[model samples]
Target chain A: MAIDLNGAIAAIGAGVAIAGGAMGTGMAQSGIGSAGIGLIAEKPNQIGIALLFLVLPETLVIFGFVIAILVMLAGGLI
Target chain B: MLRTERMQKVRLLCLKKDRRAVVHELHRLGAIDLRRSGLQLSDGSVGDEVQQISDMLIRVGGAIDVLRAYTDVKRRSQPTPVKHMALGTLLERLGSYSQIGETYQISAALKELDDQAEILGAAARVANALAGIDIDMASLRSDVLSFKAFEMSADQVERLKSTIGERGISAEVLASRMNGKEFGVLVAYDKKASIDDVIKGIAPRELDITMKELHGKPKEAAARIARELAENAKRRKELQARLRNLAAENLDKLLALREMLEIELEKGNASSEFKVTESAMVIEGWVPRKRTEELESRLALATSGRFEMEYIEAGEDELAPTLVNRPSFLKPFDYLMEFLSLPRSDEIDPTWIFIISFPIFYGLMISDVGYGLASLLLSWYITRITDPDGLMYNTAKIWELGAMSAVVFGVITNEYFGFQVTQLIGFQGIDWTKSITSILAITVLFGIVQVGLGIIFGIVNARRERENKLVVSRSASLVTLVSGTLAIAGGFFGLMPAGPSIDMAVLAVAALLVTIIFGGREATEVTNLITHPLSYSRIMGFGMASIIIASLIDKAFTPNWAAGPLLFIGFLIIFIALHFLNMILSIFEGIVQAVRLNFVEFFTKFYKGGGIKFRPFGYRRVYTVDADASDA
Candidate 1:
């Protein structure tokens, strides 16, 4: 049997959090890819800015973590 | 008839005066040669000019020296920028101090320093060549007469040792040679340093060998050779270090002067040729239209007015040489996507699609009016500040655009950030949980469609590549899509018992047949195709997994027991923290699902990536120009 209605709510929240991360990672990885091609076109020095853009998507994960902690505390799970 | 003219732009060959000064200066510098490879200079003066060849030679020579030094440093020490800097500095200092016409003197010094290490290495090698054998002491006492340095390899030497050790001969045996032969044989020796093995290693050498009596001098000669080798090796290390220090002190200066001279040449009336076709060299440059008469006069001095000059107008296309502005946000996206290598060649530009789908999908996935508003505002602001081409200035551009598409579904599903607010507005509340389940079901449906699309594309691309894997894999996928999709649709639509549909089951069986019989293009198995689509379930798994967890946490963690002020503050903190986590999780999950949607479902079937990207030989200027001017 389901633990409670709250259990399903938590389940959905977790899924949304994961999906959010996936979206960001895709954008980031592609950024990294294009940057690689650009650097190769120009040479290694072009890599600095490209690397920064590639890591920028990681902001999503930080946001996801925030949501996760909120969810946990709100439900008294933490 | 269509009126179109194919006219090559008219370029002045030279300024009316001798345009040689700047061209000559730039050739000496490494700027155009090394830094700007695709540099387009009007092919008027740079090439076929005096002193350019010597300049190129010097630059290439310096590069070789630097590369050699880099490898040498890497072998013994960590390769750091500081070491490179030291070498560069030394080159510069030596170059400036050198006497006129004595460039080779510095080069000669560098070469000499480098040679010392090479000589030491060669000397050690020759010594090793001289003392090539592993012989025991007892043999030295016997074979003292005639000894010659002979080359013996590891394997042959091993066999000789084994032969000698097994015999167990004593020192009493004779060491003798034939009168006219080069090599001598040592008679049986007692077991010393595994003697039997030594004899076995000494294979028959056809240097006209003969038997003779014991000798004493050769062993002494071998030991002397070994000593010489050790001393040479020690000297080699000392010499190498000295050369390294010398190079580190002077190499930089020489390189800098050379690079500076090269750039100076480009500033003059020199032209550079870039490769375009097999025979035609492409040279792009500008001359004042009014100055054409003077430029033509200069050209007449070189070619005696034999070469013709022409002019082509650069119309209002916005792709002007003077402009440099690019849409920052859109530009950043391409870099990001390419970094991930998400888009392959066969399909449409995903960037255009993403500009449409991402925001909408994000809003739907989030389902909070407040959060959507925040994203819309943030995206719009960033889009404006980051982009500012004037095309995307409104907040609705990001959220309302994608949101408009996603909200219909969001509203029907009653998902307003994981809760229904209909009752708060004095309306009967719809069962949001049920609608959410249905929405989730729809997400799965889309995933299947996307994956099915992949299989189709995979088959088409495979045929083009002439690879057999495409045929079977794609056929199997078709079968899976047909049977599985029919089953899912039938069940979801309530066409059957909500358990299994006969039509779908039959289609599934047919799909299995096709997969087993056709998809095994690799010849290893048939079950892979049926299972491959299952991998796509990861999309749903990741997406659903995040939402479910966030919702579950919200349910599990809502604060209830604390007092007024503390309780409110605590609740706020928890809500903020959890939302942060949700943001993180959602970002990762969205990327994963997006990738799954593309890579597995779409790309697996449709993507034929790995095409050479089209890069134009346009806008190769070094100076930054106004962004708006880039177009005109």
Candidate 2:
């Protein structure tokens, strides 16, 4: 197969978008977890707080899904 | 955040006195359990004749209760201690029996009865021995009591005879007993060693004492004989019939006897109530303040003005109460205890950390929008059953989160189920396969930023923890963040080849080294500080490896569009199986990586985890379906 630079570059853009999305998630994971620990450490009382943070990283993935739509739009896959 | 406040939170909600009651109440209600408690037969002390007689009577009752389990005709019969010399024949004595179940309760009644029987049997033999010698048997019998024990050996009898003869006094010997077990001595005597030595001098190896039921040739032979009897049609049928009839006739009577015997269980036992369903007596049970009114109402209805009711506030004794007939779904997560944790400024709970990273990693590794949707649906259903309280729902919600991530990532790569959609967008000469290179770039890119964030958090936490040294010490993280950022920016901006910005970034490296080598001296060695951040690079290496491995497995497993039915089916199975295996592996690895990040990357910077959590006194029911104790 001939190297399709245009298609490949498009793929790169899509991949970068995903990376950015994943970065948000990865960041949120550590962020929420550490924040939960910090909260638990101080008050040692907030199971609810820790639990909320525990679930917070999921928003990254949820929002990251927008990139897939962007990919479809940008690539004209639709 | 619920976690960041509440330092010096009063976890010890109950006082010592309250704790005692809590533990006591839990036991009374069969809520909490200790592994084992040492309870001796007679409090491990000698007693007067009356006390002794009562103890023996209780023992006999216990034994008869055990025998009643195996046989009928025990309705009116309470066990009576065997009158030592009254029954002169060992053959005529009664023995203890037990119910046969796979996990049988060791019948205390049977054991006590067996001990008393043995004592009386020995006494009878002693009486016979005295009679054989024609001594003042009556006087000797009255002054000297008899103890039921295993059969003594002939050599042991001879030794006794010799010892008595040498003393110029002729004494009567009553009983010679066989052990109920094997490899145990004939008697567990006060002087086991000396007696063993004497027996060794007198008896042959074959005749040395042994434990009953432990191991013995004769018993083994009997067991074999019994098995043979069972195999034979005639004997087997007869035995089976007898046992069936025995069960039919004795079942109800034995149960009734058990209840009667159970009543006796709490007669004098401390902190025990025998009247759960009996006479309406005011029974005080300590409960948490939250449940106090509820319990009062229940008691009021249960007693129906027949007895008084009192609800005591559990002070320090606030153990989780045992709810009777608890459901399987309601099993305690009380192990997730609160502690008087460290003075919190703003750190993170380990559990929350896990909850965030794990699902995202899972989604990234899977990188299949279709698969993520499947997982999200299945996990959502499981959450309803596992965490009805929404605890597990939120945890499992991450799958949906991951699905969303997968869809985004899949689109970004211009791929869906390994199909490139970017070419459809009219992008000229677009090659989707080149997206694989982007996956690596993103992996490293994300890793750099995450590592950077870890350092910032470390600095902030260190400042809050009042560690001035840590603030300066974690400056290396800031340096790396800047250097990595500059490297990516420079590369993107066409400033230089794909190397980190060394020209201006050298200043950051100098500061990084200063913090690492000097600032971290008290916390860690220069070598460790210099090398620790290097460890963060593993996120890139490991994360990339996971995605690549998954992608390869997916490709290898996917069926050929043109293949025959059987071949396609086989490939389909292989595909599903391989991906499933990869998923399971990733679940484990992702969690481990998340922990690694939390403990090594984040915690080492600013976390102090080991403060005893506060535990407030409360009542928690395991299940509503099974607290009645009727089935058990």
Candidate 3:
């Protein structure tokens, strides 16, 4: 079977988008998780609010995943 | 539903004799939050009384701690039934217990045992030293004994043995033990030779004679030490068992006494904060408006008409503590809202908005019937078993409602644990996959509605505060947001003709300009109005992710008979574990994103919170019971 160069390039682009998004989320959660632990230590009841704040940046990666899925689906790359 | 309870400032004047009873009744009623007068009292009598009460409180507190350690009922055992007593009955019981003098005796016994343990520790150390000696000590106690016990370096012991041999004095090594470079030696030397000369010639600098006198042989002495140790151990056991028995018998009494002493301590501290004179006292505090009458009646009954109380209006400069008053159903959401912030007294509380929208977003994000039912059952079981008023109970109720919402949405989406249940049953539910565009449109519409609600709430809040500019700008911003969204959608999809879209675009731009110039925040307000609705794309994004992951897990676990029984079982285990993990992540992500949209996106518009929570001066009966409630 012959490989489609354009589709492979598009797949690599999708991979880069996901990697950048995952890095962004990880960087954000690092700061948020530490601050969240400090907050929980001071006020044990803030767990829910702390968790909400900690996961706010997680949407960046989820969006990337959705975009990648859409690209793959559109291109029939599977 | 978003309002706070009204509060009133109260000042009370009572005779010095009635101060205790009035304060006691006030605490019992738990209506007022007493503020310290901050004026130093020069009266020595009140200070001395406070010190006395504090000391008694500490003693009783220490006794309770020792009892708790011994019995461990509060620490290790489940809660048991406790008798409820009125204040009078409690005092009567305390009086009877005091007459028996058992609490004091128990405390004294505990202290005595501690001292005895210390002494026993020292004796054990001495016994250890004696056990290292191997000589028959009875022979050393004879009238003509010539042996000397020496603890010295091994080199010194060698030198002494050589010198005694050369001097023609009979000496014999009885026992010797080495510790590093030092030696403990029991030596029998000639009685004629000068023992002082032998010690002075030996390792005099490194010598320590631990055993000076002996009443019996080494073996006999060791046996005696063992017997003493056993007696000490027996005594310690008896004391511990006695304390445990007392705790078991008088646990309720101990709990009540501790509470009573704590109450007295509080009264003493409050008295110190009072503005006191020779015959009268003045106390200031805040009470709920509805409870003022009840407090007045209680005070009258307690002081027998010897008190005068006055109500003062809270001034603009004064910040009254906010106590939110909502219906019972919304009370569970209070924990979540308060975790973010307590709403300011003058502003609207946004907890009701959260209660309405949070579950909808959560349901949409998860969108799986099987997972929803599982979550519902788990939360229900937890809520059933735990204390109803606790934090876990409230949180479980929130999750229970979220799961029920998910179930409803799952039925609409035709998904059950990632499988197309509607298709399996030969029916059609809303196929999210086939109608992705329509789903996207609906999610955008949901965003528009939420943003619209935010602007409306902002307008209403501004109107309440009589801020005309905010009301106008917020309303204009809403118009711009809605029209801009519709115009963009229409132009993108060719839903409308070119002429109308142009007109709609022109109208949107004009409203945006007005919102920017008049809203007083050019960049923030304009960008927020434009991008806020787009932020709701995450709703669709997260819902898609949940479905994708669930389907992936489901696809991985499709049964294949060719893999044989062991492989199939392995796959089954992996399927359960992976699906369980995915379900947890889904729930966590769903709840977080859903609440974040409301909290960060919606709340910023209308809610401004910095208010202090209202905490009344009272103690709840956690371990003890109030006979008044029991009677009612």
Candidate 4:
């Protein structure tokens, strides 16, 4: 199928959005997961709470995914 | 809709003889929290008792530690639930252990095992050292005919070489090349030639490694060490077996003793917090007002009318502990709030509010039945594997409830892990392309409502606190938030004629003027008009993100229809892995972001949380029951 210029641009935009979000979430979760493991080592009882805090920052990427999908869908690129 | 439980300050005074009984009764009732009195009452009698209890605690803890080590011989040490026994039952159980004098016996066994471990460890080290020497000896004896070995310094080797050279004794030195500590020389001199100078120059001490001695001594030592190691290992196994047997037989007794000692230690430590006089002990504590009567009755019955309790009205300056009483469904969310901050005594408990909003946001974020089912299963598994009293247990329960909510929401939305499940059954799911405008509008509208509610709550709180300026500013901000939203909506959507837009603008400006004129004390207060509404967009943002990711996963897994089995299997694995990861990310994002919105956006309006949670002095039992609680 012959894709239009706007469609290709929208697809790239979605990709960039998702990638940026993933990068941010990865950076945040790396620090949180490391510290959380150390905390779990000291107080094994804190595993659930530690895990919760460790994953809290992942919302950023999900938000990015949502925006990316919306942009693509709106631009008829999906 | 939200109210913190009332707390009453109480002073419990009893005779020194009734102190233990009174404390035990209070523990059974679980009403009062023993707090140190503000006034300094110089009494040191309880200090000695505390120290004695502490020492006993160490002994009991050490014994349990050893018991735990041996009992888990087959598997890893998992979390064991605490046991609870009635005081009478505990005392009765104590009699049996005391009669047999197992305490001393157990301690002795522990000591013997520790000593055996130490000896076994030393023997292992010696064996290792001997093994190293054996390797060196094998290398040394490989060519004894060509060269003779000497343990000497480098300086001695040099001097010996020179002295031998002067006597016309041609010799080649063969040193232990690894460290140059051991020296060797291959001599090619006449047997009659006098080599007294060489011997004098190198006054080497004997490593005693004559080729024969090297074989015989190492053999003797290795055999002795092997025997000793076998004996120690056998003894260690036997001791371990004995411990395991004892642990199996007397586990109940040991656990009971530990619990009893812990209770005694609590009582002993609590006594120190009490202000004791010559005749009586005065303990000050906070109790829930609703339970004050029950506590009073229990204390009377337990002490036989010998104690006096004076309930004091807590003053404004006093920091009373917060007691939150909520319905069972909302209790788990209360734990969520407590994880962050306990509400102050006078503040509204925001747990109910949290319960109302958190799950909704979480469900909205994930919005997929398959992911929700997975979450429910994962949480259920966590609950099953962990002890019921474990910290993760309640968290798992909370997740289970949230997952159920997500499942319900997902069903209504007709999505299952980004697959339009309803479409397979000839039903239409939500079309983002068609409804994007409405969704965004609704999202922004929800933001306006939440922020408006916050301002209204701020007004109520300010009014309650008798801050007139804050009340006026908050009220004005409420109007400003609403009118400003309307103004933007009307202008952007052409929802009304130009006249309504003018009216909305006028209303917004008028509210701002009121804020500036009447409530100018804090310039910062005006900023919430912009920040608060903007903050609520996160709810929509997070929700959209979840849907987008779910759809992406679905799109990514569109398998080739004509592919072979291996390719199909490969795609299947990738499909499961991708979707599984997306589910986890969505669940975490859903809960955390949802809670964060409420905590940051809603709570900042009315909730000022920083209070001590009511921790009544009692053993919160898990895996053990105090049978006497129902009776007393």
Identify the candidate with maximal lDDT: 3
Q: What TM-score fits each model? A: 0.41, 0.40, 0.75, 0.74
lDDT of 4 at B590: 72
Q: After superposition, how far is residue B68 of candidate 4 from its true place, in Å?
A: 1.2
Residue lDDT tens for model 3, B146-207: 65665567678788877777776777764345446655566666666565676687753422
Question: What is the per-residue lDDT of model 1 for residues B171-242, given as tens digits with 9 covering 90 to 100?
Answer: 332223323333234333333323434443464442211212112233444455356546655665564565
Candidate 4 wrong stretches, greater than 4 Å = A1-78, B15-17, B39-44, B72-227, B327-330, B384-396, B494-501, B518-522, B622-624
Worst 10 residues of 2 chain B by lDDT: B35-44
Q: Which candidate comes out best when scored by TM-score?
A: 3
Ranking by DockQ: 3, 4, 1, 2
Which residue segments of model 2 deviate by more than 4 Å? Answer: A1-78, B2-354, B373-445, B475-480, B491-504, B517-563, B623-632
- If the candidates were sorted by their TM-score against the true structure, best first, what order would they fall in? 3, 4, 1, 2
RMSD of 2: 18.9
User: Which run of 10 residues does model 1 chain B get worst, by summed lDDT?
Assistant: B206-215
Report the C-alpha lDDT of model 2 over B1-632, residue by residue, as the tens digit: 21432221111112222322333333334312221112221121122422433443464455444444555443344332222121112112212323332102334333444564454443433332222232232222232332112234565566755754554442333432333321212222222122434445545233211223112233343344344433444543454454555455545444443333332222223223212222221133333334444444443443342333333333452332222222332222212212212322235433344345545555565454445555667666867667544445544554455556655554444434443445585532222234433443454455455555556766776776687777777766566456645754575555665444565367556766667664645434433333344343334434444455556866677788688889989999887777666555554444345434444544455455443332222223221222233343
Q: Fnat per model, in the order given?
A: 0.00, 0.00, 0.45, 0.10
**Could you give the DockQ of candidate 3?**
0.45
Error of 1 at B330 (Å): 5.5
DockQ of each: 0.04, 0.03, 0.45, 0.17
Which candidate number would show the highest DockQ if scored against the true structure? 3
True contacts kept of 4: 0.10
